[model samples]
Target: MNDVPVAVAAMPSAEGTAVARAAAVVGGPPAVRCTGLARRFGRRWAFSRVDLEVAAGARLLIMGANGSGKTTLLKVISTLIPPSLGAVQIFGHDAGADPAAARARLHLLSHSAGLYEDLSGADNLLVLSRLLGRPLVDPVALLARVGLAPRPEPVRTYSAGMRKRLQLAALLLKDPPLTLLDEPFAALDPAGCGAVEALISGLSGTVIVASHQVGRAARLCDHALLMHEGAARWQGPAARAVEAYTALHGIDNADGGG
Candidate 1:
């Protein structure tokens, strides 16, 4: 197959370190940048007046209600959907101007399992590996890493947890610079959640996980961004972010399912 020259994000200097943009005034490394981000379905503004910056290798968690623009904000950042009224910059490159370069390092795992039920777990992973333009890793090892050890069965026969884990294995491929996990913990067993948390604990790179699971996010992330009606209300440390959310919403059930 012809390796079409897919432009990679201009490699950042200083050994994988991104430009740190703590303040909007001075420029620095940015994994994600949003200015005046707004989305409108019709007359209603989903969100507006949102500006945010995140440095390299920071794991970000988005906290909000089901319809409060958490997913919308993620979509815009991942370049899946365009913001109607805002400009987004990812990895120091303009999202609208050079999305391809940004997307090379971007991986978005949607709410649904983007796996083929008809194909076996190995086949699904191999297909993704080819698209990533990299050699596929050991399927059995990948499956075992995610606790799906007994392999070589049709994916359609697998349980929802198994499928989700398989999708996660594929997501780990390409070593994407930015990873977006939407409700990543949905439909996992207690053991699986703990395993995933352990796996994500020291994960190196930029990540944005949109979920209402504040407790999990607190343990798993370094930074947290709160979105309400499509705008950023607060952004800071994980613990403080959780505290702010507890004050606004409540501590009850902030962990989400189970």
Candidate 2:
């Protein structure tokens, strides 16, 4: 066997160092970070003091009943609404100071379909993709992926579930690194629900899902944050977090009964 040259072996390769640095950045930084996050509408606080950190590729489920601030929190994280207090960092970009950069890395799907009612499903997605500077794609393919047939009629004529699927297809076309989904399973038939779940399971980026379907959402998520009355009750592994939320909800009901 030939002996390797000592000079060559001793030198540190620039490419190796660069790769290591990239890995360090990806592994070290949390994909989403919130500190002392609070949002209010008039005198009512939607959520308060919500400190959270989620790494890249994490599936985080926000569990709560109605009026629990799940939608509000997701809106704040997505930079759709400014926080009343504290800070949010998405992929290390400050949402308050650098909303454009943060938004570039995030996609939000609210309860509303957020589509142009007058436009056809394909047209709506095409318009958004162009506006967002995403690659122009065949809307029919995307619609098919979401289990919606290509139709010429306006989205105004679509059923609730069809509209929801159309919106999902549009966002999937954007394919941002961070996704915020508010009640993804709502307004879906059994087949539509299965399609959404499958899509979520296939995603490799970070996801924050706000849903009242605790059991189903918990199954899809690795981590969970349970909220009640605009406050987080527990944040941890999904199963335990669900248990904590159930126990806390029960306690609140018992107190009310008394």
Candidate 3:
């Protein structure tokens, strides 16, 4: 791990205690930390006074109904959107001010492919690889690594799971230390879900994933967050959260409490 290259992206929680802890104990900083994090649209509050921390090798699962500010929180942590209040730092770099630096080590995956549908898989990899200024890897090989065949069809023809695998390949190639995943299980078959979950588990980084599937969340995370109305109603072990959540709000029902 000593030879592992430093990340080029902005790290979101590499400062304060996290930095000291990471540097002293192992190889990198804690995965993420959000302190008093909030977002507001005029008088409306998307979220407020949120505080959380994740350690190296930690996986955090976030669960919430729609409009609960789940995506908002992820965006704020990933440097994609600025918080109306509070600060986010990665590896001691300011995510808002030094996004490029933070992004050097950060990987974020969402429903959007973030690929050029008009281009080949190789082309997509080459483009983003160049953009990130990392070592250029063979695109065909990358596709194969993700279990996609080297076909001539444009990325537009890829199935949802294939696209997800491609995006996952890109993240894997980067070997980033911090990853943010949003609803990665959508449209995936049971086998596909297992594949994705295994890939996530194998990634040697700190991961934060947002998903509605309590089963996957429980398997992939050391802890889980129950977000409702833009705040965390409960935060603790993934299994405990699942049990508590089931008790508080059954699989058939939807509300916030346990």
Candidate 4:
């Protein structure tokens, strides 16, 4: 049997060094920029007065409790939902002004699997690849790369963890400059979790992840942004950011799972 790829290894120790190396290798403009970014639903705001910048090849983690706008912020950045106020730019393209171009540079993996229940995993990827006007990739091969054995069953028959792997395989079809992940580790099994950590560590571009798993995030990311009540409570290096988040939540650093 072939060995698992380094990108899919689930070891806790695999986080910092690999991600830091990727961050150090690249420079120049920020891959993602949000200025005074805010989002609202009717009379309520999802997130407001948010300013964020992620340098090329950097790994950034977004930490917050439920309803703290982690998901909302990611949606705005991915152009999936429009910001109620302020501006967003991806690779210098104004998200509001040229959403099409901006979106092309980003791949968002949100809570929803975004797959067809009745379709086989490979078929789902094929449809998306066609929609993007990109050449098709062998979905089975891609699934194997993510630590999943390729199967012919419909996506609806797969467990939550399996679905996540299918979604990730779809992502590997494109080489987007920025990847936005919301709660990537949720519902994953031990192996599944490791696969995600390894993939993030191996990515060559910028990444922004919103996860409540502070310890895992801190390990996988070099920078961190903490949000509370729809506002940025803290932002900076992962160590200090982890400290700030722990201080607010009154939790010990070790309790933030890896």
lDDT of 4 by residue, 134-162 (tens): 87857778778877776788888999998
Give the lDDT of residue 208 in candidate 1.
Answer: 76
Candidate 2 total steric clashes:
0
* Per-model TM values vs. the true structure: 0.84, 0.85, 0.83, 0.88
Kindly give the stretch of ten consecutive residues in candidate 2 with the minimal lDDT sum. Answer: 3-12
What stretches of model 2 exceed 4 Å from their correct place? 1-28, 251-258
* Full candidate order by TM-score, most accurate first: 4, 2, 1, 3
**Model 4 misplacement above 4 A:** 1-15, 19-28, 253-256
Which candidate should be chosen as best, given lDDT against the real structure? 4
Per-candidate RMSD vs. true structure?
8.5, 12.1, 8.4, 8.1
Report the Cα lDDT for residue 175, model 4: 61
Residue 8's lDDT within candidate 4 is 12
Name the lDDT value of residue 229 in candidate 1.
65
Residue pairs with backbone overlap in model 1: 19-28, 19-29, 20-29
For model 1, how does the per-residue alpha-carbon lDDT over 117-164 read when each residue is reduced to its tens digit? Answer: 888898888888887788875877876777777567779898877877
**Model 1 misses residue 81 by how many Å?**
1.1
Residue runs of model 3 more than 4 Å from their true location after superposition: 1-29, 252-258
How do the residues 1-258 of candidate 3 rate in per-residue lDDT, one tens digit apiece?
A: 111111212223221111211222255555666667889888998877777766665667787766778888888888888999887777667787888888887888887888899987777888888887777757787778778888778899889988998888888778788889988787888777877877887776677888767665556666678787877778766656566566656674322211
